[model samples]
Target: MTPPPYMGRTFPETTSHYLTTGTDVLDSAGVEAALKAVTSKGYGPVAGAQLVLLCNEREADLISTWRRGLPSREATADEVAADANAVGPTAKYDFVLSASAPAYLTDETIVGRQAPSDFNGLPVFDSYGEAFVIKSELIPAGYVIAAATGGPNSEGNPIAIRQHPNAAYQGFREIPGAEQYPLINSYCQRSFGVGARHRGAAAVLQVTEDATYTAPTFAV
Candidate 1:
C-alpha cells in the first residue's frame, strides 16, 4: 500500500553537537549518558553519523537548559563579555522534533482515530535549523538515519525494506472481524531484506522514565 500522508513531509536537517555540561550545575553523568548513547555504535565515515535523540517534554526542557547554559568554547575574551548577560545559551544544534511529527504516535492512536486537525498545535513543520535533538517517541527502536543525497555507495540512503518494484507491497483490504469500522489493510507481502547498508550512519539514544542525569556536586 502507499505510505500515509504524514510520511510526505521531509525530516529536519541533520546536525551534531558535543554534549557538555561545562560546569557542575548540570549533571555530567547525564550528559555523558547522552553522549555515550549517541556515539555508542561508533561513527560512520561516509554518512558522518546522524544521531537522533528521542526525549519527552521534560527531557527536552532539561536538554535545552543544559544546551543554553554551557559556555562557548570558541568565544574570545572580548566577544564573551559582549554577551555575558545572556540568559539562554547559544544553540548550535538542530531543531527538536516535537509531538506534531507524523511518526510520533502510539499504535492505538493510529488505528482508533482519524488524523487530527492539529498535532500538538503545530499546523506546519519545517527543518529545525538549530538543534539535532528530536522530541518524538515514535521513532523506530534503533538509530534513525536521516535521508540525504550525494555519497559514495549507500552512505546516505534511508532505512527501508527493499523489495521488487512490482511485488513490493500488497493492496488495502478489509478485515473479517472489523467489518463495522472502516479499517483497511495494506500490509507488506513481498519478502525483502533490511535496506540499511551503512548501519553506523543512523543512530538514536532513547531515554526511559527512570533515566537520570547525575551532575557532580562541587565544594566551595
Candidate 2:
C-alpha cells in the first residue's frame, strides 16, 4: 500500500492564505443634512422642557431622512396628527439617548405624570412631534440615535443579521477529529454576518459643534 501523502510532512507547513474586505456606502444628501443639523450646535443644558424640543428635533430629522428615499408629497392630516402626538404604540421613532440624558428629563414639568416603577422610558413631546427617550449605558456621552420603528414587514428595521442557508453551518458546529479512540478531539466553527439594513431609517447625532465628527472611545 502507498504511504500516506502527509506521512513525513512538516508540522508548521503553510497552507493557503485568505483575505477579507468590506466597504461602507456613503450617506445620502438628506441623511448628511440630518447629521449636520443635530451636531451643528454643541451640547448644553437640556433640562426641564428643553428635553421635549430635543426629542422632537431628533425625530423630525429622522423622518426627513426617511422621506428622502420616497417621492415628495403633502403629508395627510392624519399623518400630521400622528407625528405631532406620537406616543406609546403610535411613536414612529425611538430616541436612544445617552445614559446620562435621563437626569436632564426628570423634572416634573417634563415628566408630566408619575412613571411606573417598571417603566424605563421618558416620553417627550413638542408641538411638532414626540418620541420615547430610552437611555442606554452602552451609548457614549454626547451621542444619541433616532431610529425608526414599527413598519409593515420589517420595513423600518435598520439592522439585519444574515447566516448560511444550511442549518449545520449557521451556528457553532463540532468538527470530528481524525482519531477514533475513546478520547475524541474536536473543534467548533460558525458563519454569519451582520450589517445595517435601511440606511435612512436611523440617524446618529454626535452632539457637538466641531467641523468634523469624532467617534467616541469605550473603556473595556
> Mind giving the per-residue lDDT tens digits that candidate 1 earns over 1-220?
1111222432233433323333323332333444443343343223364333344444444554333235323343554588875332344432233434556543432222232223234232222222144445443322222322223344453355455566424333333344564345423333556675534333333322223322333355
Q: Tell me the lDDT of model 1 at 137.
A: 40
Report the C-alpha displacement of residue 180, candidate 1, in angstroms. 25
Model 1 residue 127 CA deviation (Å) reads 10
Screening candidate 2 with a backbone cut-off below 3 angstroms (N, C-alpha, C), the clashing residue pairs are: none
Residue lDDT tens for model 2, 1-220: 1111232432233221111111011112222344322222211112111111223343334433332234222343554687964221122222233323344543223323322222224433212123334444556555555454443335435557778887767777778777675337767787778676644344555545353456678887
Candidate 1: C-alpha lDDT: 0.36
Model 2 residue 74 lDDT score: 37
List candidate 2 stretches off by more than 4 Å.
1-130, 150-155, 179-183, 218-220
Q: Indicate the TM-score of model 2.
A: 0.39
Off by over 4 Å in 1: 1-52, 68-130, 139-155, 165-194, 206-220
TM agreement with the true structure for every prediction: 0.32, 0.39
